[model samples]
Target: MSTEATQPYQRIVQDVRQKIRSGLFTAGAKLPSTRELAETYAVAPGTVQRALTELRTAGLIYSHQGLGSFVTDTASETVGGRTDDWMPDAVRTLQQQVRDLTARIERIEKGGD
Candidate 1:
């Protein structure tokens, strides 16, 4: 699919992803309804639905038929049926932060401060 066709949905995905990572949307938090999200983002409901689907696919969130979507607790959820080495965006960002912190600690230990 063309990138342009998916841009709106991708924007929503990034927004929701950042919120989840920053703890603005806590685990099991009910996501704003798709209609609400669409209005907020000024996109069509279908675009918001697509964004939610992407988040679900990445294991960042989930949805029940009658209930709305919710943030997934990475500690408890096995995302996308893979357990060992799947690194989604939020996890990757966290991993990078850890690596940076470790480097900083090493430098301090070496008196590189």
Candidate 2:
């Protein structure tokens, strides 16, 4: 997959993760709505959702049914911790590769490739 093709959601994930790690987005901070994030990043809502889903999976954030997503209380701990609780580098790398491949496949299916 081209780097450009995989950039949008991944960029959002990286930026949000950085903010969490830097304490710019403190624990329990409410993230913007999906629509707001989409507008901020100039991407589709689905892309923002994908980035938020990755953050949630990494234990950095959580979402309520209607209240919207917020940084998890343990988010800073998770970001700073290097324990078994945190995902290993290998796992993260593989996950990125999987996302790239999935995007490539989707583009091909849509005849965008």
Candidate 3:
């Protein structure tokens, strides 16, 4: 077996992905900040940002401007998974309501009842 070195940012992406898949960082769990992740992984913050970008593009995590990143449901992107204990019930409820309303509106617009 050849020992090949993966790119630093890709390594971050893989590790985080594995963690999420293994349920260590289950859906809606807040990921560590870029700075913290950089320190933990001993990589530059920019590298962490790149990994985060990849995750975001893949729909694995979502971020709010000041709130930071949280994992999304990898199994079904349309429905949000369970959130962290610290996440407010109202926020989760509101998110679900929005999704439901949007889906209803879409169906209506398509004349699909």
Candidate 4:
């Protein structure tokens, strides 16, 4: 399915994040230009720009104005004293998953399976 039809900016942010997290976009490496990502993903450059903005806010990447955005080194100091946005979401998701699993196990033990 063409998931890009909904939430284009979110999809762009996710694609870039996945690439960085997967090591496809490396630390200190420049990301695809807004024009390039927009063309490749078949979306407007504004959408790509919004995605880049989100990444910058999350501290996973930064821009150089004359240059392009680059993946920030994990150990490097963050821009604007921020932490990556994905980190908190992942931690919460894991916590919720653990709780769900415990509840499921309790149900199974109680013969609710």
Local accuracy by lDDT, each model: 0.71, 0.76, 0.69, 0.69
Ranking of all predicted structures according to lDDT, beginning with the best and ending with the worst: 2, 1, 3, 4
What are the RMSD figures for all models against the true structure?
Answer: 14.0, 12.9, 12.5, 17.1
What tens digits encode model 2's per-residue C-alpha lDDT throughout 1-113?
A: 35476679998988887798899999768899999999999999999999987886676777665667878666787677643346776685455455545645765899976
- Model 2: colliding residue pairs: none
- Ten consecutive residues with minimal summed lDDT in candidate 3? 75-84
Give one digit per residue, the lDDT tens place, for model 3 in 1-113: 22157888888877887787667887668899988999998999999989987676555676655567777655133223542436576665555445445645765899966
User: Taking the candidates one at a time, how many backbone clashes does each contain?
Assistant: 0, 0, 0, 0
Q: What's the true lDDT of residue 17 in model 4? A: 68
lDDT assessment of candidate 1: 0.71
- Show where candidate 1 strays beyond 4 Å: 1-6, 75-113
Off by over 4 Å in 2: 1-6, 81-113
State model 3's lDDT. Answer: 0.69
Local accuracy of candidate 1 as per-residue lDDT tens digits, 1-113? 45466599998887786686666888768899988999999999999998987776666766656667877666134432445355677775564445445645765899975
